[model samples]
Target: MDHQPLVSLITVNYNGRAFLHGLLESLQACRYPHLEIILVDNASADDSVAFVRSHYPQVQIVENAQNYRFARGNNIGMARARGSIVGLINNDVVVDPDFLQPIVAAFAADAELGAVQPKVLDLQRPGYLEYAGACGGFLDRLGYPFLRGRLFDRVEPDLGQYDTPLQVFWGSGAALFLRKQALEQVGGLDEAFELHMEEIDLCWRLHLAGWRIAVLPESRIWHYGGGTLAQHHPQKFYWNFRNNLFLLIKNLSANRLWRVLPLRIVLDGLALLNELVRGKWRHAGFIARAYLWLLAHLPLLMARRAANRPWIARGAARTEALLYPGSIVWEYFLRGRRRFADLKYSQAFTRRLAYGRHLSPTQMEGVEQPYGTETV
Candidate 1:
């Protein structure tokens, strides 16, 4: 690879002309010299396509006739990417000019690194972290995902506590940095997910294939959470509930899946009950429908499992190393352990976490050296 490799930053826009100006201005200011911007317009009825063509003639545009949402839309852009490094940035984000530097450096340093995400702050409230992906993503044994600085609905302030870069389980789709070769090996994002949990699934596949995903705190970006799907929208709930199940079914090893899936079903039911009790009947209904959809589509889910098996067989298959063994739901709701640091992590996981700690300047420069496997 070149010292400053070509980075293809792909943003999928769906009637988000309002957010384009900030995104374009930030891209123009980016210090990276070999960057190319690709805008995949998901059949936006707005003047989004015309606006990009008029204002940013240098950007490559992929026009889709219908709204493909996140999974398929990003896959289309990834396919068209000419860079060794492919970036997935949401239209709702404004990136720091220097964000690409650390990302490029990290990728050059580590051959096994599949993806990297910047420190994501709230666009509306710059002092706080964003809910979508605060500082890279981690999942519990049951596949409940939470970030370093954000847990479920509770997002923490950016206190520099999570400033240390580390190997993470997943990179957020909102502002994802990926390696083109790794994506091709894993067959890109699962279009079936449509929107939610797709990034996590991709990262899981990468991990199984002997690649690492990471977070770079030195780089930062602000995200306007829920640009396409509002927090209160019933469709968001449906996708979140339904696709999360799909994620576990597709990626988790068979031995692990059989043990954890039954518990996940019960936990999901409790979530639905909580929604109903809170008088959010519509959200509750979406959860019920999500379950029904999953049950009706078992064959489809099974097909996905079969397709993903070859990668898992070839991979290190160390899923337990990155997974938090305790149930996040039990800790957050029942035990009131909201802060990431407050939880009592097992000694085994603490050692693994230590191995995944951020690289020092010296170590960063030396990352090109062969890396050994961590004990799972």
Candidate 2:
């Protein structure tokens, strides 16, 4: 309960009133004092706006005129936050009562740590940790985000196995703790992303700026999991794939891009063909356009990367040796286990966890989503 406040927890809501209500209630139960809660509603049609206005009078609200989508919505809320630290928790997630304090303390404990994500449980299945961010997230060489507790759709159960706090390539936005200075230095999440993979883009910018990211095991949150793409929304597919391709074009060095983009493109072609065979026309279009979009907008992405090149190229640290991409990515989709976790320092290696602390009443093993009464 410091006077200036320590962290501002922001949640973006879109047609998920019941879920946001639960999420806010959990925040109400949190032990941290001097916390500011900002709820950005993406033009909900139902009683969501009215419900929060009537019930949660104490929370700050930003009611957008129309759906700005997740990325823009969060960017709006985050920019308005007054605290030095910002907590980006999904509206569909519920945090443990003891979560915020430890996370804030961790930030206070280390000046270099730019961001941290809490251990996340899957609400739909209590015993299984959510794949979105089991103990933080990582990217293989190809820009695929696979959490330590999960690789793709494969999620592991928690049994006090991953008990220690660890550093991660990127923190999960599901319940991420971020430094405001870093956001100011790099700007908030990319509005171009519109959603999906935006957090990775933000973290990579932080890394280039010499900030560290970590997973705080002491804090715990349970996410409903894949709230946006629950059934493959077109916007979801488009943003996830497009932003990933953009990540490569915008962040990777030119030499690296020229060396490996062709293989990645081939993989994407196969994915598009498979989607086309399944009659997922939009999905296929998404994959096809991801590359086309990159091609069309190469000038802009190149300009952005060129602006960043000077900062990275001038860094004293060696950049080429630890830069592992295709091998790590190939393992994520083809080999399953992260090949670099055992290696320690590889210019950029991958790491994942399969454990987290449980907080639900079930006291069960994983990500359980018991909605009390609400249905999907």
Candidate 3:
């Protein structure tokens, strides 16, 4: 126990009392001794706050005035956390007894390791991968997010295909384990995101700051997906699309931004059309609204860039290697490449990962070049 670091685990709860008992009970089973659970309740109207206070007095509770959403809610907990390591987990997940072991080990193994996500399996179907983040996340050339065991809508069975630990583009926020140092360095999560895709943005910023994000399949957790929002909810669609666009604009270098942003727009159009064809007219409307909102909030986007200047100034190393060289949308929709193994990367990508580690000093020597179109 002396060798283990104290982990301050935080869960964002919004009317999630029914699942709280299970999560708390599962955590009670964890063998890790140096741990503290912090529950951030986003003004839960139900008896969630009362229940935690009654049954789990040991847990620290942060009550928000209103629904601050995921990013802000977790940021609040991080501010109050006392441990060196921080864990941002959803209220709907249950962890194995050994979950914290591998995570602690991963951080101890690499000084530059900023965050690690466990192998998230579907709670209902333990044999299958979860929707939030199966084994680790990767960004396609078009800025589309996909997991090692999951494509657009396909969740694969857990046959240990992604068992090996490796560097990933992003770690899922569902059961995210992070270093407090890294979290503070990048100013924690971006509040503008409010909900979806915020974790990806945070991880990408960490990458730019010369930190690594890894997936530790050796540590496992079962996530009851869609706890806060339904899979097909229009609000979910709005946040995902909007925040993804924000990531492309705010995070990408000027040269790469110009090249990828146009393709992303066209790809988004195709997705909207597909939704219309499938009679998901409301979803299509959500996407349109997201685009219109982005256009109107150009000033806000500029402000975000200014906020992210610290991480941007740190530059990037090995970040480009984590991205899928091919377009995932085209491969999934046209070529029907549902499995991650089916997706292809150029030989240069393999070589890049091989030699990327040694190029760290050169990459971190400078800041990202600006687009020069407008100032924040």
Measured by lDDT, the strongest candidate is 1
lDDT of 3: 0.83
Each prediction's RMSD to truth? 4.3, 9.7, 4.2
Write the residue-wise lDDT of candidate 1 on 294-321 in tens digits: 9999999999988878765665345445
Candidate 3 similarity to native, TM-score:
0.91
**Residue 256 displacement in candidate 1 (angstroms):** 1.3
The lDDT values for all models are 0.84, 0.71, 0.83
How many clashes in candidate 1? 0
Best by TM-score: 1
Model 2 TM-score is: 0.84
Candidate 1 clashing pairs? Answer: none
The full ranking of all candidates by TM-score, starting with the best, is 1, 3, 2
lDDT of 2: 0.71
Which portions of model 1 miss their true places by more than 4 Å? 346-351, 354-376
Cα-based lDDT at residue 54, candidate 2: 93
Per-structure clash totals for the candidates: 0, 22, 0
Report the lDDT of model 1 for residue 70: 91
Model 1 lDDT at residue 333: 85
* Candidate 2 residue lDDT tens string, 1-376: 2433568888888888878778989888988877899999888887887888899898899999999877898989998899998988888898899887777766666666688888998898988778778877766555566666775656778765555676667888788888888788877887777777888878887876777777776778899976755724655666767788887767665655665578777877888898999999988887777777777887888787777676555431322222333455456556556432432333223322222232101111232222111110
